[model samples]
Each structure stands twice: as C-alpha cells, then as structure tokens.
Target: MQDVISKLVKVQELEMRATKVSASDAEVIKALRKGIPDPILAHYDRLRIRGKKGVAIIRNQVCTSCHMGVAIGTIVTLKQGKDIQLCGSCGRYLHLPPEPASETAVAMLPAKPKRKKRAAVRVPDAS
Candidate 1:
C-alpha cells in the first residue's frame, strides 16, 4: 500500500513537471516521500498485473480484480476505507475502501426505531 502511494506520488510529481515544474509540486513530492521513507513494493504491482504494455483488464462496470460485474452492494462497501472488502460476487482483490461518513451520509442513516409496548392479552373468561 505504501509502495502504491509512493509510486502515485512519483507519478504526480512527473505530471506536475510535465505541466510546469514548480517548487510547490516538489514540496508535495518531498513531503509524501518523507512520510513514506521506505516503500514495500506490492507483489501484484501494476506492471505485473497489466504487464509492460499495460492492458485494460477492466472497463465500465467490470471489476478487474474479480473479473465479474461488481455488485451495487460491493460498490457501496468500497466507499469506506483505504482498502475495500473483496467482492462477494468475485474473489479478486478490491482496492477501494468504504467512503468516510459525510453530512449526507449521516442524514441517510435510518431513524431510530420507536419502542413499542406489547398489550397484555386477556384470556376469555371461562364460564
């Protein structure tokens, strides 16, 4: 994960350079590098996954990880954290985590259920 972030930082730096090459970009890169001094390269790196040329393993709604149609539930689950839960639909590893709670999210929560009292059942009077 750290490796991926580090690589992303590097790529962002390169992009920034291609655009204008400013000290701000350098600072951003430096900060990210400092935070992640050592990067552990993931065995399933992008290069290994797509190969040198890079292939569009997934597009549209298909999940490259699972090679299946990602369920709506799976998509919602991935919105939470840095690492998302593997899809129930497929076993392939998922990258996105559940998304952080937002204002709308808080609002979306179901309202608390009101406690209901059970009325005592009267047995019919025996003659």
Candidate 2:
C-alpha cells in the first residue's frame, strides 16, 4: 500500500514537472502509472484534470490539501500501511509523512507561545 502511495506521489511530482517544461519526463511518468492500479489511476486522473492534487500529505493528523482533521481510524490504517486512506473532506488520497528521528530531539526544542485572544469591545449605538 505504501509502495502504491509512493508511486502515486512520484507520478504527481513528475507530472507537475512535465507541465513546467517539455515532456522530458513522459517515459518515467508512464512507467510509474503502470505500477498503480487502473481504478486508482483513474481517480487520480479525475482530480488532476480538475487542477487538484491527486495525493495529499497527512501532517499532524490533518490532511494538508483539505486542512481537515483526519479520522483516527484512517490514520491507523495509514500507519499500518495495510490499505490506502483518503481525506474525507477533499477526497484526495492520503499519505503520512515520515516522522522525525527522535521524539527527544523534538521535545528538547523550545515551544512557541500561544497568542492571547483579544476581547471584543461593544460598540455604542447611534441615536
């Protein structure tokens, strides 16, 4: 499953590159497409045709494309690499980015302070 997702991501990147220049990556993109299933490729093509990304990266348990929180079950399935996951909001395929090497390294970093919310002032009504 992860392999399929990786291929999809690569295909997307290659296609994006192809758009910026000549069809130099045509062969590579074709080969990558062969590895992906037809139904999956068809769905990806539908999204791409609409100028939307076919695959979305999952960061902090959220779909980057849709900015919507991903369901826990979806995340679990993605982590297990047992099946493909899709963002419920945007319908794009989801891939979990690789985690940082060490949690301690991240924990040792300083945390950013949260901004305080400003209270709204009531406006006086004009007589």
Candidate 3:
C-alpha cells in the first residue's frame, strides 16, 4: 500500500514539474493519473483542493506535515508497511524513509579520545 502511495507521490511531483514547463504536459499528467487507483487519486485531489499535501513523511514518530507526534504502535505499523496509514492529526498519508547505509557505517567508527583540561598557573606576588 505504501509502495503505491510512494509511486503516486512521485507521479504527482513529476506532473507538477511538467506543467510548470509546458502546457502540452497536461496530457502526460492525465496519463499518470490513470495508473493511480481512483479512490486514492480522488482523495489526493480533495486534499489538494483543501490546500494540503496528499502525502507526508514520518520522522521521529512525528508527522512532518502536521508537526504532531504519532503513537508508537501506529509508527511501528507504518514501518511494517502492512497497510495504508494516515496521520491522525492532519489526515495525510505517512511514509518512513529508509536509513542510509553510511549512517550505520559511521556509527561503528571509533570515538575520538577526550583531551584533559590544563590546570591554570598562578604568578607569585612580590612582597
């Protein structure tokens, strides 16, 4: 379900970019819309009419569009990608980005040693 949503989001973004370049691109947008499920597409159109994004990324268990935290159970379900999940607060589709390979590799690197602070020296005063 999430995969379908991802593809639809990509198509929508492409259509938006295409329309900005040439009016002839309207045909391409129409073709892209045909591939999406009618219900999902209709929902997306409704959201657009309401001036909100149809899809939103989930980061740190929070919905990026609404800036509201999602419950842990819902986050787990979204990560599993078993079903379509919508943000309770803003009603936008939720997607979790895959963690980068470099991040895990960097985490395994050795930590830098801490340096000790030098003690302050005091000058003796002449009597």
Top lDDT model? 2
Give candidate 1 misplaced runs (Cα > 4 Å). Answer: 1-20, 40-77, 82-127
Residues 1-127, model 3: lDDT tens digits = 7676776667557655543645556666676677778888888888867766887887765779878766566666655678777777777777777756443332234443322332235767877
Range of the 10 consecutive residues with the lowest summed lDDT in candidate 3: 111-120
lDDT of 2 at 124: 81
TM-scores for all predictions: 0.29, 0.76, 0.64
| Per-residue lDDT over 15-63 for candidate 2, one digit per residue giving the tens place of the 0 to 100 score | 8764563465777788889999999999999999999999999887678
* Error in Å for residue 107 of model 3: 21
Model 3 clash pairs are none
Q: Write the per-residue lDDT of candidate 1 for residues 1-127, one digit (tens) a residue.
A: 4244434436443443455657776776556545542422232233335432111122333566435555444444444334333333433334442234442443344443322332235878889
Between candidates 1 and 2, the lDDT winner: 2
Candidate numbers, best TM-score first, in rank order: 2, 3, 1
Error at 96, model 2, angstroms: 0.9
